[model samples]
Target: MPIEHAMNTISERHRADILIIGGGAAGLLAALAARRKARERSIVDSDFRIVVLERNARPGAKIRISGGGKCNVTHDGAVGEMLVQGFFRKSEQRFLRPALYAFTNDDLRRMLRKRSVPTAVRDDGKVFPVSGRACDVLAAIEAELRDASVDVVTGTRVRSCLRQNGVFCIHTKMSDFFSSRLVLATGGVSYRHTGTTGDGLHIAASFGHDLVPSSPSLAPFFLRHPVAAALSGVALRDVQLSFRTPSETVSRKGDVLLTHKGLSGPACFSLSRDAADLMRRESGGEALVNFFPDFSAEDMQEMLLRHASAHGKQLIRKFLQLQSAIPSGMIPLVLKQAAIEGDIGWGSLTKNARCRLQRTLQSFSFGEVKAIPLDAGEVSAGGIALGQVNAKTMESRICRDLFLCGEILDYAGEVGGFNLQAAFSTGWLAGSSSASGSAGTGV
Candidate 1:
């Protein structure tokens, strides 16, 4: 944050064959692709005259904070699933396939290793740099840009963009820039502290791209239940959070952290993506949690009954406290909420109390979700319509010589490295195609 734009930082107005307005994953990848694809070293080519402008003084600030500083570069899953069912439409998937193929997750790992950041791939196939530090990932990527001879301009902000003589001219607070090709890897609206202030949407909208209102995806929820408040600090693992719409029920399996607000962690983050989407509009949606997701309602009821029958000599208060299923501090509260007196031993339990225990433990319900704000998320949903782009080339059909990639287009994937993979794929295509100037929005 101590970066200052000395006189050297503001050299002069410039022109480039390809100008990128961001230096995040997509932007940096564009610089790499352009550097790799240029025809000749002559000014005529200028290696596509690549110039990457990042508002952040240092590149990859978000990457430094990703995966809780571990840098989950890419998920360890079949790429097909990432491209499909999560949220993107068919055309969006098609538009992303080309770049994804060009630069696979393995390729990213290899690059990181070369930069001295040894990487380890988890059993789930999520590739992380060996150091398990996001700073290392950023270092590797930064090294790539430096080695690729990318003209990266950090702390440069674009004020406006204009179309002139079929070419786009960008006006920035630092200076004006012109480029034969323009790529906006400005990222989505999430993590504003990392500099993704939704600026790309404004720039793309100015260029005639449709703007989709981005919401907080992969964010924590706020519950209205006092029980939730009482159990706020308790962390639940292997939980199932079912996201409910008017017509469908979908669930994600993982760990969820109980916050004063609601839930967080992978289970909640994954569910939050859908929660943010389905609840983006005025109509509300609800997230129902199954704490003991591994067992069915009947199985849980049977377990509770068995425990009660076995501990018939103990009081309900002692029963809850002695059990490992719920938090110890919450035993009295849980029993009280179940309307069971805490003093009576398990043997003194009436049939009504036993039934209450079964009902309370088997399936608990939460309230209708009012909203999940955009800023609370790790990623934002919706982007430029992918239908107007070329799936193989990542070229834009709406504008000749204009290519779309990353979150700039409306192809948001799930959490855990899918989105970064998406960005890498589209950025590769856009950067490679930018040199030829034949790219079209994957139509």
Candidate 2:
């Protein structure tokens, strides 16, 4: 949507004690937190009005589509484990420490449970609704908001926000909103269809907060040479992916999905930010895939020699299909890449051929990354700089009553449930602090 100038003639006007923009994961939780904290403070509900302005027709559009419609609400674990295991950078870990601990994954789960939305934790630690429906999670949160008497106005596009005489004047397309405390949870630039188009970042910059120059994070890579159709849906488990950036080598280990375009899944998404950065910096950036991340070249050679000795008459392709971890569909491609014949017996393989095969297995070239579209990312990488925001309160240091939460902040977590957990945590802290009118006094 195009930005329009605030009109002199206001169609309508609304007032609230606390106003939250963008009713996404963060905004919805922020409204709930504010309501809960206000009650705890003995503030009369009728006297203090909390409002949420959402551009979409309904709230939590992104949430409904997350985790392939299952909605990975959060990662099930202690806050420390989540911080250490899910987030990669130390700076990000430090920034998220307080909020994540304050409103933990367990807390989130408990809230869902109360709303009659039972959850199940997968073996990989992803917490999802029992019914496997993302809409159920959104519905539960919406129910909480309704019960709390938090007014959520949908289809409201904010044109501009300005602080005038200790009041935040938010000019939307339909009406004007005024509030003392404002929460910007407009999310990031990714998932444009869901209404997260970096509006919050722009608003923050207007309020004197620096931005980190947005890029696509947790996105798939489109390769120059696409993979074969047979390998399109094949999944590689426990694989490592390495990409060379202008500054350093970025590597990640997890499961990878071979798409016809290139790669997807946890491992590829993890490296996407760096890969996108690398592509932006220069062309011809190549990714290397390590099918056997746990095995060294010598170990692989030794294993191959043992297999050959045991089954001398076994065809190389047949050995790879039955004995190796390489997928059946990928054997032909692997043989071709290694310059080996599929018909050749393992016993007849030359020493040079064995070494080539070992090398190929260790670092198979995934080809040059053609593109990593920023809009295609699950979450964006940049937003308001973290140092400008009070981590404990989720309030901006530059602007006192203005709080920023969710993907609007510069931290973008890995794929899974880390991002949503961060959103909930920060939103809770932001709402709680805004309601209490002081930092560290929030619930």
Lowest summed lDDT window (length 10), candidate 1: 1-10
Candidate 2, which segments miss by more than 4 Å at Cα? 1-13, 245-247, 438-443
Best by lDDT: 2
Error of 1 at 113 (Å): 1.4
| lDDT by residue for model 2 (218-266), tens | 9988888989877898988888888865566678898888998888888
lDDT of 2: 0.87
What lDDT score goes with residue 10 in model 2? 29
Model 1 TM-score, 2 decimals:
0.85
Clashes of each: 24, 0
- In candidate 2, the residue pairs with backbone N, CA or C atoms under 3 Å apart (3 or more residues apart, or in different chains) clash, namely none
Which ranges in model 1 have alpha carbons more than 4 Å from their true place?
1-13, 39-47, 81-95, 224-232, 243-250, 281-287, 306-311, 317-323, 345-352, 366-370, 437-443
Decoy 2 TM-score against native: 0.93
